[model samples]
Target: MDEVRVFPIIITKNKDSSEYPYFVEIPDIDGMTEGKSIADAMKMAEDYIGTFSLENKLPDSNTKLPRVEEGAVVTLVSVNVSEYKRKNDNRVVKKTISIPNYLNELGKENRINFSEVMTAALKKKLSV
Candidate 1:
């Protein structure tokens, strides 16, 4: 597992959005994403961090979060990229696959899991 990292964030209230009022951004990161509440913003920030490759972020003295204004808040958010990948990469996606009728029938008769078998075969073929 990669070491857990804490990213500082600035959360600004959005008067323009009644539903999702929190606007969150990571100082060490380049983009901003929004959420409905403080907690939502925190989760969104973690996910946002997860979406970027490690090359995009570097912690330095310059990463010190900006001071919060009256309607804004500053906080630290933690994300373990390896843990996030472990938790998220297992999502199963529906895929339409084709096989020879004889092969399909043989697998069906033998009671095979198409999805699991296909995933394994793909992983082997792709060297993943």
Candidate 2:
């Protein structure tokens, strides 16, 4: 699957309240969220989609977008699924690894953090 996904969103003025003036509709996912401003609404939409992507519940992007209505703004919001998952999935797992005794001793002498080093190396190798 592509790392990034873009979805169409509709933003409308919330006539009911002035505090959160924007109402965002994510038609693709059949979801809605409110924001105090246009920028905030867009961000909420991205976050909502990112959460859904993590759950493997995102709908096909090829689905037809809802028709634009008067006084409503239609735009696209893009999220990098891989990046989102990397940032939000923070559970850590322990592993057992073996290395040369001399290298391990040298690392200990230098007070290196093995887990941190391994994480960095893995991230670089995977380009995440």
Candidate 3:
């Protein structure tokens, strides 16, 4: 089971031409990132939270929101720590399984990717 947590953030639009368009800051996690659009900013925020979840103790879901500056806009972004770990963690663990010889031959003949197929099956089984 996974618990999703939300973090409060401030977004500042950049008027400079060279730098990224949006600068984001999440005070609770002491995180900051920049993006080119609102969507990118939100995704980066989620990524920052996910990374923080990996490096630190999972904070309480009810953690208080951090105060924002007068000109900055505030928002809450949520990330699923367990889900993020499942998707992003790179340490690999190998598994062994068996399939019908004929099916395996057919897959190989069709150039099917066994690892992709296995991962999809496992993720579906785990409801990930």
Candidate 4:
């Protein structure tokens, strides 16, 4: 069996960019830091946590949150229960995926996710 560990995170507003007013991040650990802001950032954080939780088999338990201080706000975020359950039941893995040369070339040309292109192709192929 593998051991699992959980860490705390902090969110703060950027000093420079007012438009990007929030960040979700774990504290520095061995020099790994991926920061996010705005709605998309939160979503990215969710995906990141999902991956981390899956890899570490984080427990499906409510966190023992600390009491909030003055001038602080707490926002409740939601995730798909089925997705969380699936992550809890599986282990994260690293694997390389293969794509057609044309797909790869087009992705490079467009600077977009190969998955997005693949999804579009599949949709068109199936006449969806």
Per-candidate clashes, comma-separated:
0, 0, 0, 0
C-alpha lDDT values of all predictions = 0.80, 0.87, 0.82, 0.51
Error of 4 at 122 (Å): 5.0
Residue 88 error, candidate 3, Å: 1.0
User: What value does the lDDT take at residue 103 in candidate 3?
Assistant: 94
Q: Write the per-residue lDDT of candidate 4 for residues 64-122, one digit (tens) a residue.
A: 44345453333433445356656456443454679789978988998987666666786
Global lDDT for candidate 4? 0.51
Task: Tell me the spans in candidate 3 whose CA falls farther than 4 Å from its real position.
Answer: 17-19, 98-128
1-128 per-residue lDDT for model 2 (tens digits): 64887889999998998999999999888889988999999999999989887777676564346688799988888888889997888679899999999999999999999999999999999897
Candidate 1, residue 19: lDDT: 88
TM-score per prediction, in order, is 0.63, 0.67, 0.68, 0.39
lDDT of model 3 at residue 105?
100
In TM-score terms, candidate 3 sits at 0.68
Candidate 1 Cα outliers beyond 4 Å, as residue runs: 54-63, 90-105, 108-128
Model 1, total clashes: 0
TM-score of candidate 4 on Cα atoms, chains taken together: 0.39
**How well does candidate 2 match the true structure, expressed as C-alpha RMSD?**
5.3
Pairs clashing within candidate 4? none
Better of 2 and 4 by lDDT: 2
What CA RMSD would you report for each candidate?
A: 7.8, 5.3, 5.0, 9.9
What TM-score number comes out for model 1?
0.63
Write the residue-wise lDDT of candidate 3 on 66-106 in tens digits.
Answer: 57667666788889988998788877678888999999999
